[model samples]
Target: MSTKYKKLILSLILDAIGLIPIPFFDVVWAPASAYIMTKMYKSKEGKIAGILSFVEEIIPFSDIVPTFTIMWVYSYIINKEKVDTIVEA
Candidate 1:
């Protein structure tokens, strides 16, 4: 498997883990997840998404946002289309 697909799978797993409903888990998981996001994605986009993930996880009941997966989609799907279009132009 390519690195991109590996990152996608990792993002899905991270998002699923974030969904755990254990009380106060967010307090500990939030920062760790954010760090993971930054390291996993890298670059400015990763930093931005990492911040968003941190905030989303920290807020009560907002862990369902799946920020990592969303970032993966944005990076691989949405951003890829834009790049392809630009190249085709």
Candidate 2:
């Protein structure tokens, strides 16, 4: 598969692992997701996604959404043009 798909799958797995009900898992995951998101996309959207993913994991009950994977899809696929517009601003 392509590198992008690999990164997406990795982010999804990390997000799922972040959901485990173990102590400090979210703590580790939140920052990790942030870093991964930043690495995957070097743009404003990536920065926002990193922060958003971190927040989503840090807040209890907010982890229901896989922010990292969702952001990946949004930035790279679903709304690629939108991110470019934001970056140009």
Candidate 3:
């Protein structure tokens, strides 16, 4: 994949990681996710990844997994690339 798309994917993964629940809400999660996804939207696909990250923030901690799943689907639809890997860092 091109470096830009790689970066976008990396950013999306970062958003996903941030969305993962903890004892306290990660306040930085949604905004960071939104910023990266907005950048991706502006760069390539028109769909917004940040919005899904926002949804995770709006919901309770337990709901993050479901939100992540939805976002993954959205990513697939928009990117059309079967990237088997997901980032941990």
Q: What C-alpha lDDT do the candidate models reach, one value each?
A: 0.83, 0.76, 0.52
TM-score of each candidate structure, all chains considered together:
0.87, 0.78, 0.47
Candidate 2 vs. truth: CA RMSD?
4.1
Give the TM-score (vs. native) of candidate 2. Answer: 0.78
**In terms of lDDT, which candidate is stronger, 1 or 2?**
1
Q: Which whole-number lDDT from 0 to 100 does residue 42 have in model 1?
A: 66
The lDDT-based order of candidates, best leading, equals 1, 2, 3
Deviation in angstroms for 73 in model 1?
A: 0.7
Give the best candidate by lDDT.
1
Candidate 1 ranges beyond 4 A from true positions: 81-89
Q: Give the Å shift of residue 51 in candidate 2.
A: 0.5
* Candidate 3 lDDT tens digits, 12-77: 566458656565555666565566555544432323445765665655653445444444455555
Report backbone clashes per prediction.
0, 0, 0
Instruction: Please rank every candidate by TM-score, starting with the best.
Output: 1, 2, 3
On residues 1-89, what C-alpha lDDT tens digit does candidate 2 reach at each position?
96667767887887787788887788887888788777777787789988988898888888888886887688678886765543211
